[model samples]
Target: MPEIPNEQKKAKMPKSVPFIIGNEAAERFSFYAIRAIMPTFLVAQFFNPAHNPALQSIAEARANELSHLFVFFAYFMPLVGGIVADWFFGKYKVILYVSILYAIGNLVLSLSTHDLSLFSTGLIVIAIAAGGIKSCVSANVGDQFDKSNLELMSKVYGWFYFSINSGSVLSTLLIPIIYKKYGPELAFGIPGILMCLATLIFWLGRHRYVKVPPTGVKKENFMRISLYALKKAFLYAWKKVFFNRQDKTVWETVAEKYSPEAIDGVQAVYRILAVFAFTPIFWALWDQNLSEWVLQATKLDLHIFGYEFLPEQIQTFNPLFLISLIPVFTYGLFPLIEKTGIKVTPLRKIGAGLFLTILSFIIIAFLQEKIDQGGRPTVWWQILAYFILAGAEVLVSITCLEYAYTQSPKSMKSTMTALYLLGISLGNIFTSLVNNSIANNGFFARYTGASYFWLFISILSGFFLLYLLVAKRLPEKSYVE
Candidate 1:
């Protein structure tokens, strides 16, 4: 029994994809437009008092910490978002409602540009809205296609990602220039206006969408069953370890009450979640594009033939590479590889992605050595790393969305997507610990700062090996339809 039909396995993209694509471009523009200038704005505008130097130092460090905290909250909120959408409000209602919150949050940001308290409040509001809508919007995109259209789901997501980069490309590059030119109010205000338009674009297509209402499943049921299964599995394993393995019937009666299909679904959800746990490390590495990479480039050469480039401008190359390379990988390279009689299963691509990430960091490690030794490293090294990291993203990040949507039971699609986001939250937490360790001159920062880069490269390599072992032992059929 194949999960997808063979006849329609080849992609034939749908018509409604454009609406979602357009909406996503606008929404991402809103997101990145503000995010593009946020850290600098926090330090320069929000943290700067009438003209106090000591307060300025504190504000800069606080701004950095707050930025990471904002990201952590944004990812963590998906837990609430997924559950609420899955059990209470449907995806459509939640997306529409939370999008309003998103709009309001941006408006608050625009208004509070000079006021610290209100600006902080605005960011928290945006985090709430971002978390709430994160899982549902991607799930909503999946809902547009049916089982017959499953093959095209991957293709559609490719373009969905394409739209994301398209939006981010412009926002990341254009908005910061605005902030530098006009000031914070107009910079934030522009994104707010885009957010309002984003809401309208989504609203306009309300009638054309395929809405998946909540399955009417209670959160209690999932929690209660999860506890039951864990306790039982632990007890049964203990009985086998300390006692005889001959009497399986002792546990049989306890498991008999649940339907076999229900148990299978539960197990599937658990397995998918375990895989998601791998994602945060990937994101911890991926997110550096917006943070560490930009800061680090300021230490390098940005002048090309007398055309001065801002360190922030270095960030634009990510989206440029993303937009250019995604089509090559999705439409050209992957299909060509498939024709060579190789199976590029989702899990395998994930494993491949982790290794590519390791390679990217290894380059960073080498460059860090150059910087530490008072040698000037070329900006090209960072671009090479970006190219490798971008490839890793196509392999891991894009595939995760498609995998999370297709593998989960219809009732739990959003929930599974939220669980995937949990990895990113965890990854940020891990990243903070790493940063703190390096900052405090603690155990992880053994050599120069170069050790920090090597540490992540080593960690990701180990993770990839573990993935291969666990994947080889598991039944592949358990994951797909």
Candidate 2:
């Protein structure tokens, strides 16, 4: 292939790139718009007016917890959707179908604030759609480029992530304005419109996408083969090694199929499964930003430019911080580290990111302790937390996206991306579990809110450190350019 000039490469993006990015921009706008207002909306819509004054606080707490739980599940549904896409439909088909479902979810949400049951159901559908679409879209971007132009793939993903943050920032700002001024109906309705636009954007690029076919029976056969080998190995270990049976048939069969030479597939499975074990801790910390952290902010002194900020607006800083820092880290810090011969492998970056997460929580914990002691924490405290968290996100999330796409086998690319997302899903489930535990007033009752949060962060950081130690030994793989 002839070398394409830098200017031409800049001007001539892949055909499908615009549509995919456009879709993401609109979809994120819709999703974040709803998410930004959900907690406040739930409090206003679900808390019982007729309740006793004493129980109102409890009722509001329950409402907030339930709303965050809903958000958690919404974030998680991609795991199932991703599996389905890998096993059944191609990524394109899955995305198209799920985008419609996402639109319906928005519509359902827009239609009613009075019916809590219906609203919850709508949110569930949205989660399913979002999950289904999330894994496929990034993988699809990789599909657009082959070996000839693969080096540009990372740049494409960077742009993709940039678009996501950009959309999120806009929606974060607009959703609050809509919620505070126009009310829930308009606030919810606007997102629904944006979702529809996102669907249309996706459809417009149908022919441009380099669609990959589903794996179908080949994937099933591979799984079956792996399972059979594993079973034989276990049986042989029991009979020959332990029981000292005369039968060596199982041992022979296991060696023939699952010997060290043929274990890559099995090793991949084990490694992927192992990563999931610690994923939920990440999610638990992530969910706090929207639920607990925002709630905590309401109690702080947030007088900025003579305006008392809404709790939800605190989230805007996360994306703002991300946008500002991406350029600085990409051009400045990364180059300095490279020049100094400091290695910045994905695993190391993730470990560093995990450590940063601990710092973010420590900042939060300190602020909370001060607030508990009758001191008003500054808005800059929240800004600082967002700054640290955003840095961690850049290291972990962007690198993970690259890792998931490249490490996966050609046929299972979407599946690998889905597994990557499953971490977030498990994280959400973890949040739900924690929230439920706290609500029950059993084991966690001894700790105050800040202490409870600090404990969770400390535990997560420890788990993340362990994960990095183990993952460090695993050999890296990259099939994509």
Candidate 3:
């Protein structure tokens, strides 16, 4: 008799799931711990004392630029990581190797509190270390399920995200306080220790994992097709412009050289990339939670329940709210929406997130106006912004994580995930450039104070419209089955 089809097989959780989730939790704790303290630490250690009333704006601006640049590099390096994992090392080996670098980077940071060059070198290494494995980890989680239990994949991703925020909530709340009472050394050291633990946790699951071997450097690989397509386009352009010859289109030229499957794979990558193109603005607004939002909190009155909260600590709300919001949306909100005879698709969720992000920034702009006019606002206003932003994040970030994996072709999963992450990298780099411009008195520097928030709101609104246009025509293909 023919064996049962995998889809008809019972859904079962993989034994390796716990290890991935646990490793993610510890790893996120390490990342967020240092991130929570970075803005204030930069000002304290590099520019001027954190508390000095002189050149405060300069110090804050410098902090924002450096912090955003760091985040940019962290997100950007995933492209290299994805390429390395998908083409040569495989996910398990790449993650294990870079994780060692990750631990060392944190140790370097912990020891270099007094030396700017040492700190900068350490930050670059950490960026490479963290980003190098970022795509592999999540993609690896998806690798654990086959068509036999593909139905369980979404739930696993939810828990995966839940663990990430759980770690974030703890670190964001605790680390800044450590930085305050103790010093940067211990605050940074703890994350290094946690990273080593994260590595150990991952290693323990080695035998249980469903390891996907690297595809090696095949001619039909996505990277090869992409590179060939580029070369063809360049030659085509050169011929068209100089030789006054127009024969075949770029696609025609590419098709001449690559297989149909390879060409289709590259086209799929382009389509997914098109969807991702609109997302950088969302990230530009989202990552501000760590940089600009923290600065805004510093200007507010942070005392509550007889304890003064650090401005950096206030960002704890994003992850804190996320820990609660994930389940509510997964079990409560999504199911409730579907019951109304409406299908809750990924694009719909992302649209809702984009709209909510607009609302959050509007609220932030209003609060900033009050502050710009010399009125001290309550911490609660920013808290509200954080809550709404958290809701947007639940809808966008979590959905993208699941959607990217489910939609990617098997050969291109890590590459697609890396592209999704590149949006964050681009967003942060955009943010860094904007802040750098403002610091150096470049164009649009006059849009300061509440106007700065308005500028982002305007950009996000325009992009949301563009997203709607593209999303409607975007094709969906699932490779998981």
Best by TM-score: 3
Q: Model 3 residue 465 lDDT?
A: 91
Model 2: per-residue lDDT, tens digit, 97-117? 889989999999999777988
RMSD of 1: 5.7
List TM-score per model, in order. 0.80, 0.84, 0.86
Which residue pairs in candidate 3 collide? none
Candidate 1 lDDT over residue span 116-165, tens digit each? 89898898888778888887777788889876678778888878877887
Clashes of each: 0, 1, 0
TM-score of 3: 0.86
Q: What is the lDDT of candidate 3?
A: 0.87
Per-candidate Cα RMSD to the true structure, in Å, reads 5.7, 4.2, 3.9
Which has the higher TM-score value, candidate number 2 or candidate number 3?
3
Local distance difference test, candidate 2: 0.75
Where in model 1 is the C-alpha error above 4 Å? 1-22, 43-64, 114-118, 142-160, 204-212, 219-222, 234-254, 304-306, 330-343, 372-376, 402-413, 436-449, 468-471, 478-481
Candidate 2 root-mean-square deviation in Å = 4.2
Order of candidate numbers by lDDT, starting with the best? 3, 1, 2
